[model samples]
Target: DAGITQSPRYKITETGRQVTLMCHQTWSHSYMFWYRQDLGHGLRLIYYSAAADITDKGEVPDGYVVSRSKTENFPLTLESATRSQTSVYFCASSPVAGTEAFFGQGTRLTVV
Candidate 1:
């Protein structure tokens, strides 16, 4: 695909189980981010990677981990998913910061 894509647009898991969300960008953007959006609260950054071998934590990195082994792929994993982690996850990318961003539709995760 020429645009970003996410797998398992919706997910259901039990607490303490591992869940991985996949993201792929055809543009091969240098920067990729994972954010979770809740009903009352706006999107909160979970993790981000500037490029392969360069990853950093964002606003709410707890319970989430991200890796970018390739320029076009960034995957987010929830080690021991929790009920609080249930939310809509969005993957975003940009050639650089403070510029136009492309976002995947979203992955809705439910941890019971």
Candidate 2:
């Protein structure tokens, strides 16, 4: 069974455009989250959803948006990409937080 998956393993974009990152899971986990990992920022949450149709902003949701219409998919969109947003984005799923989490390979986004 596929645990989780992320698209575009790598991406290069300009400083002012829109990009959407895709996430999918087969476990049907009720909790899905989006996070970005940078050299110094470590791992910071962008958004999360406890269940279908229920979403909430996380620690770093300023330039990002997320939607969870189905338990199996959670997609993130950067309304307008920025150089500061250049980082690896990861999608994670878990039954709950602070426990073992399953992560996607990650999408390395570079905005020049």
Q: Pick the candidate with the highest lDDT.
A: 1
Candidate 1 residue lDDT tens string, 1-112: 5999999899999999999999999997899999899988899988888888899999999888888889999999999999999999999999987787799999999999
Q: What range of 10 consecutive residues in model 2 has the weakest lDDT sum?
A: 93-102
Every candidate's CA RMSD: 0.7, 1.2
Instruction: Quantify all predictions' global Cα lDDT against the true fold.
Output: 0.92, 0.92
How much does candidate 1 score in TM-score?
A: 0.97
lDDT over C-alpha atoms for residue 88 of model 2: 95
Query: How much lDDT does candidate 2 score?
Result: 0.92
Backbone clash numbers for all candidates listed: 0, 0
On the 0 to 100 scale, the lDDT of residue 11 in model 2 is: 94
Model 2 TM-score (2 dp): 0.94
RMSD of 1: 0.7
After aligning candidate 2 to the native by TM-score, how far in Å is the CA of 17 from where it should be? 0.9
